[model samples]
Target: MDPEILKFKILVLGDSGTGKTSIVRRIIRDEFSLVHSATVGVDFSVKVLNIAQGLEIRLQLWDLAGQDRFNHLSRLYYKQASGVLLVCDETKPDSLDSIVKWKGELDARLQYKIPAVLLVNKTDLIDDEDEGFSEDDLEKICSRLRIGSWSRTSAKDGFGVNECIKALVWDILSDKESKTPDPLTKTKDVFDWDDDCSSSIIRLGRQDLDLANSRGRARKCCH
Candidate 1:
């Protein structure tokens, strides 16, 4: 018999009201919430996907709370994360501004490099010329941060959300084969501290570390 396929953990990080929860709900449960409620701590769900080559994979998605006080709790979820869905609300420019911080937190706590997909959520809200951010802006941001993959999604309409998740999963699995290195071993090499490059990477690393430490303390408090 073939060995059991390993399960991959994908973390969703973004500012509050960015629709991180909505995307997850739409994908996992085929549900969407018109009245948004802040996620108290963290929410989780799982889905099985079949990729190319008949590879069956289980994705354990952890959705972290985007509030400032709950930010510290994110580190615990990142420990063994295989990938991240960094979400930003396309309708709100301020949420886009916080993307740098969210990405940094993931890098520091996990201390490992993982495939990241920047998701510009609420695409359905784009009203003609009123859309604040453009596809070009997203490309520039991702290029600067070395986040090569990205997608525009509308959880309300279920547009491009599933495709984004599948694409991310495939990318992660593909990287896994090429690197042939454990997640922890691959972290340092993935992030480079270059002054010429955008400061986004460094910011992400520091925030991740801080959140990780904070989560550790929180765990102790629980016990």
Candidate 2:
């Protein structure tokens, strides 16, 4: 069976120092790095995720710089974007508040709102509720911003990373199913398992002939 493969350009956005790069590094490499240097303009990477027995998706992660200076460069990468990941630092309230702007800019550029997930990163805090926005606030933000749902994630410890992204991928799949076929989706080239049956039969026949010859040689030696 030829599995279907869907490729999507997912945009990741947040204010500067909101752990956007950290989340990207964690998802892309499965390893956390302390260095959170500001992305120059845009950082691109691809991740192939298996969905079912054969279905898969290629997520093209476009990590947009959080700096206001790069705001002009944001539109350049907005084309063909199928999903979005709006991240916020759980330890920084301002960073979380800036998600609204990111959401607004994304909605403004895209013809239609694609699937989006809001992520609260750095949730290893002892008292996250007190230190940052509360769960109630996050829900309200998600509802107001038109995001489907929100999740708590710790990129440093790799908590809730894959689950959140998988949720978004599923949403993208559902969205595409309800409408026109996604241009990015295509059937994967499947191997022809039965095409070599004749070759296998020939090899087995040769093996059996060799075995008979060895048996004949043993009989001659015994005689």
Q: Best lDDT goes to which candidate?
A: 2
Q: Where is model 1 more than 4 Å wrong at Cα?
A: 1-4, 50-54, 181-223
Q: Tell me the alpha-carbon RMSD of every candidate.
A: 14.0, 18.7
Q: In model 2, which range of ten residues has the least summed lDDT?
A: 214-223
Q: What lDDT would candidate 1 get against the real structure?
A: 0.68
Clashes of each: 4, 0
In candidate 2, which residue pairs clash? none
| Per-residue lDDT of model 2, residues 1-223, tens digit only | 8766778999998987878888888888888887667899999998776543355567899999888998888778888899998898877888877898889889899888888888888877635335666666776787788887667778889766665676676567667766865543432221112333432111111122111132111000100
Candidate 2 TM-score, true structure as reference:
0.77
lDDT for residue 182 in candidate 2, whole number 0-100? 55
In the range 1-223, model 1's lDDT, one tens digit per residue, is: 3423658899998998889999998878767879877888999898764322223457888998888888667658788899888899888998877988887777778766888777788978876654557656776777766564667778998766765675566567667867775553333332222344432111112223211122111000100
lDDT at 180, model 1 = 71
